[model samples]
Target: MNFYNIVRVSVVAALLGTSCLPAAAVSPPPARTSAVTNEDERLLALFRDDQRREQAIDPLGMLYRTGKSDPALLRQVFTDNPVRALNKSVKLSLSALKKIDRAKLSPERQISYDVFLYDKTEEAFWLRPDMLALTQVTPLDHFGGLHIQFPSLMAKGSAVSYDNVADYEDALAVDRAFPFVLDNAVVRFRQGLDSGVVTSRLTTANMIAQIDGLLAQPIEDSPFYSPVRDFPDTVPMSERTRLQKAYFAAIRDEIYPAYRRLRAFLNDEYLPAAREQVGILGMKGGPGLYRHLIEQQTTLPLEPEAIYQLGLSEVARIQREMDVVRKEMGYGEGDLRSFFDTMRSDPKFHPKTKEELANGFSAVGHRVDELVPLFFNHVPRTKLLIQPYPAYREKYEAGGSYNQGAPDGSRPGIFFYNTYDLPSRFLTGIDTLYLHEGAPGHHFQISLAQENTALPDFQRFGGNNAYVEGWALYAETLGYEMGFYKDPMQHWGTLDDEMLRAMRLVVDTGIHFKGWTRDQAIDYMLSNSGMGRSDATAEVERYIAWPGQALGYKIGALTIQRLRKKAETELGPKFDIRAFHDQVLMSGALPLPILEAKIDRWIASQKG
Candidate 1:
């Protein structure tokens, strides 16, 4: 989820299990004369049942926070028989979904029903035997590898709670299963080989590098040991010593051995068989697979060519805007490419050191914090923290990202900027980056949604790619209205980030659906924007690793922008920015079409 997770959410979750529903587990709703109200309680209870079942399958996800959960202290991450679970879970959920009478539901209930149906339908499409053949085999990739994610989970003061002795024991239990989880990935990879389903040699090489990086640290010096180095005084001395010994043993005996096994298999076998081709379309049943992935990510039935063209137009439009700023800076008359080259090479645009970059982002964050009230009526209670990406993941990650905090506000939301290559990190774009990854973007949207208790559990904690990233991208545009991008360079900085999203639309789709090579994507990006070769390469590889994902940011941002224009036009002077924003944010991460419908309803009501 780290890199591949950026703005995208899957419509089709690979839910699998062969269990029949227990309809009577939940009681029916209170009596209602209307058809909508009559079924709301009964159906919602069933919905809750299904959600809990899904959560139960993902115990590690459930225990991601620092403390207690419904099924507390469980350590295993992957669901049981995950590959086979897809068919079984989808068939059952889809069957259950079909039984619900959507026509009987009220407007609000109807939205819930439709959202559920959308997810189930997409899941049904992918779980079909042919498509599943393409997906089930390819269990791990460079971007979302557990090989990279698990250690972070085990690292001290992280997600897995270390508040109590039981928590410590739970950590051990989870650690014991780490080897099985890695071995399961191996099992899936072997299965993929039999079916001619293999990942790119490029991604495989990255995974190998990742595995080696994890192994490079000595057992005592490992991140997994960081959490235990200082136990709370509450933990008894003898028990603390026991945990210390057990952790060392787990790393030495269990965790390391599993990684070594995976590393050996990857280098010796997987690499040799890994495909030279990058896109998923080249694989067996890849056309259908790629199409479904696009649909699942974008929540629209858009063709790849249409999206590619949209990218080109957006890129051109943003470039024109950039030209205005360039001219203002007294460089517009000169060659556009040379100006871009200067921006790329100019040391003045970049931070001299990591601390300077961090402090710059923090300063921008402080300025934005004072400006939040001017734009929005609602601000999230959750705090935002700016930090650099960890040493291990910085190589694979983008320039910046955000991870949502606990809904309870127990954990502060973190905005991680990549400090991997310090010199290439630009100071001009820091304001835009902070806005996108921090307040009024991810922090505002994500925190507001998670904090809204009126929404259903899925809506609160769950998401869609369009509304989430779209809203964040849209938030950047608000910087101009809020007067933060007053500097010609700062305004261009926003445009610079906007151009990258536009480029993603072109490059991501081109690489995946149109058979554009990695270098083509990189070259196009370098030519169009101020991105250095390293940044271009990382972005292209990311698009390759996760197809159709980059399309979401621009596609989503445009949709929100269009909706705002419509609302302002229809409501005239009566349109309230506060209410309009609330209308968008209060319902959590709606699918784009659903979001549009809700905005239409809000507009009509405001007009009345």
Candidate 2:
């Protein structure tokens, strides 16, 4: 999943909303009429109702998705009560969805019905009382926490537009609401502390540091103040001074204090109580939560051990491929460890300046654009922008991430490459990174779905990580077909990335299920790949903060790869790579089972 999309547990909880449902309580569809009773129309209406309810509960999210400012929505702060309401709404929607006879619906609506069921089921699982207790209580983390995401969300050209006077007012409302969200987080954390379901000490420390970083910034210099600094022509000149004062005051009085309060709480109380064991296995009811996360994330009933074993096997296989790349580079004599050392130390493999780093990614993107038609039949109409992460966010941010643009082409998709600790970052992986996070990866997958208005909003906007991240990981492999990995170092870079996903399978399970330490997980990552220490540490901690999420990349990619191989074998000369991709992507992100079934149907159609 893209970094920004992986929001805080609270953000997700708010997105899920207040509701209740028994597990597996969806009723079967009502009896159908042979004459066609307009079930598709009824289903479409239900989808529209669901979207309305979602906007009511998750206005901020809708603002991001649509790029339309709603002052009413922007004025509201996130609260747990809304999450409960959202749950009830989702349950009602699910029940209503099941009441429609699928047989009477059009084939297109049938696909929508299946995807809706899958999405609601997952939503219900996360919103369940027990599940919420385990997840929603410890909402903030160093990765994907509100403190980090809020700044990025409020930045210029982000989801929300800052174009007019009312737009600036909407931002002020949002700015004022942030403290309430932070306050709510404090309440949740305290509840977790009471219940003994607190975050890990490592995660807590990282979060405190993040909060401290935010607190240290001057009021006007804050990201929240960024909007005030740049008034557009549309924003009336008369309103500028007022908006600027309002923004600065909000940041100084509301935002900074909230950060400081949270920081103090973490350092004084939560830190002492935080668990040393970083894995979910150590917390109250953690193992069950981990198991649930595995199933939820991969959209399959996979055991941790099974995933771990798969990861191990994948790691070994990729290593062999790495050896081939090494040998081809005339490094037949030395061990991979030594070669990794050379790659790490070699100045040629690292960018000297941030500009050069940004240029490198832009070059990779342009090269992919030139070759995209050979592999993809569809490219998103929305433009893609490549730039380095802003300083405030770059510190703890992932190496690279893609934030999708507005569907109507109002905003361009952005691929933010990290320029932090530039020397530690590798240039070898630039091609693979661009392919995964930028073109034909997230930018393609997310933008295509958003732009396709024919699909229901849930199908267009909602997605499972297995298909989303899995498709991105699979996109990385196309580098080879496009000849981007001909250089042995570049080939190794792709393999190293593949190894990162494979190791996630093992290390994630090993930490949570097999009782691996944070250090052990980090060491395993460092030793197995050419990833720098900083990146390895951040990656491991991310898994700790969010269990079972990383599993999606390799697991999802493997499913897609296996299906593609099956399609190639079955269709022979009839197989069209572009068409197959369209089949996989055009439906939006699907659960693995649904995606596999869809591909199988496509293959049968090809055969006929």
Best by lDDT: 2
Instruction: Report the error of model 1 at residue 7, Å.
Output: 8.7
lDDT values, one for every candidate: 0.73, 0.80
Q: How well does model 2 score by local distance difference test?
A: 0.80
After TM-score superposition, the amount by which residue 80's alpha carbon in candidate 1 deviates from its true location, in angstroms, is 7.1
Misplaced by over 4 Å in model 1 are: 1-36, 65-89
Please name the candidate that would achieve the greatest TM-score relative to the true structure. 2
Clashes of each: 4, 12
lDDT of 1 by residue, 1-608 (tens): 21214422111221211101111111223235454476676567657766655554554445443333332213222333443543466567777767778777777777777777776576567567676567656666676556776677577745566877988887777777768767767877887898888888888898899888879988877878876789887788889888899999988998899999999999999999988878767777666667767776778888888989999998999888888888887785676677888988989887788989888888888888888787789999887888887787888878888876767787787888998877677777888888888888988887897676655666666666766778888989988987878888788889889999999888887888888888888889989988767778888887776667677788888999999999999888998888888888987778899889999988887778
lDDT of 2 by residue, 106-196 (tens): 7667888898888777787777788877877787777767677778788777877887887777667776767777777788789889889
TM-score of 2: 0.94
Q: Give the worst 10-residue stretch by lDDT in candidate 2.
A: 18-27
